[model samples]
Target: MPTPAATTTDLTGRLAVVTGAANGIGRASAIHLARNGADVVLIDIHESGLAETAEEIGRLRRAAHPMRVDCTDNAQIVDAFQRIEREIKSVDILLNNVGQSARERASEFWCSEPETWDFILKLNLYTAMTCSRQVVPGMRERRSGKIISIASEAAYMGSQGVADYAAAKAGIIGLTRALARELAPFHVNVNAVCPGPIRTAAADRLPIWEQYLKETPMGFAGEPQDVANVVVFFASDQSRYITGQSLIVNGGRWWS
Candidate 1:
């Protein structure tokens, strides 16, 4: 097999906008893009973490613009992206990474309240959709763009509990594929990344963290960098012909 290092090329003049970039996969993806020579815009509700992440990118001599906004709020997301375009110019790559479950623990769909379901759906599904709407217009005007969503492997499997969460993630994949078809004429690419058990802070707080490890075939959790590398690939020209694809980044473990 060919080594991954050999496949990447310099992203000298590209600009990538990453949401939910305060930590976890989002942070890692921003670092990877900056290292590869892409100007980065970091968006997250966590102001301190966002600034820290931007500083890390700055150390690499990359321009890092940090924006603090509640992704779940449509108005905030709208204003944020508008400012991004006005000040930074068109976004060449849009990383729709702002998503979260209502709670860390799983909840049975039948027993869950409608309010819980609403929160989960809005966060996981609407955030991506809302952000995409803002960025795609600029992309279309330029006749070039890429949209990469951070979906979940739970979308593919009938994962028990968290039914609302699973459904929302599934919706992302659907949106990616459909949007790809519409945006293809403008030379815009759309794709999704479905990562498995990544050992992020949220996962560490899980009650059954140990149990998850036991099921992973790799016997360890995946790191944020692992997913980050893939996001860079999707954002790069190397994947020019690839769109509407969902890359599953599980450590050889399948849980359903």
Candidate 2:
């Protein structure tokens, strides 16, 4: 087994495409990969934020490319992959990091708006499927690739107010397993990191964050880097023999 220090240095020269890279775990993952010598392309729906990420990564003496893409749209997703292929030549790693969670009570689908449920499904689950579809062909041809999806711990331990979110995350786990089996022949690994409550800007306003912290075994929620580090591990050659797995990094709050 490779030690942590050894794995950090193994990602050098890899090319990674990280979706939802404008902020939070995605941004940190892109930066972390760059710091370790990977050329990164940041993808997100936010144009200005993506530019800022690119600028910051450029300051680190590593290359960063940002593209504003609505990943839920299959046409747009396909086009972005093609553009990246033509412009960057190859994408050795893919981080499906875009996700949305609802605060509505769980098991209350009767009260959920159809539009809201649809949007959450498209954002959290279908987008991963669409993006992976575009990238796997190239990976199969190259006979090497890493596909890492960011899942939530709620997928395992159901949450109170996120039925759609939990369902989508569980769906992602199933997708990861199926893809792993399908891609194993080509040496492409598919996995997910299910993080517990993270203190990102988007979740800062939630009143329940403190409650989650209190319940956590570590006595605190996690940071983006906590999740990013696991992502980097799955995306690198260090995990050449690991696949079809979901590594839960939840501060020991929940273990299976």
Model 2 ranges off by over 4 Å: 1-8, 103-108
Clashing pairs in 1: none
TM-score per candidate: 0.94, 0.93
lDDT of candidate 1 over 61-139, digit per residue (tens)? 9999999999879999999988988898778989999887656546777678888888888888999999999989888
Question: Can you give the lDDT of residue 224 in candidate 1?
Answer: 93
Alpha carbon lDDT of each predicted model: 0.88, 0.86
lDDT of 2 by residue, 46-160 (tens): 9988998898889988889898898877798889989999988688899999986864333466677777778888998999999899889989999999999998898999876
Q: Residue 124 in candidate 1 has what lDDT?
A: 82
Query: lDDT of model 2 at residue 251?
Result: 85
The lowest-lDDT stretch of 10 consecutive residues in candidate 2 is: 1-10
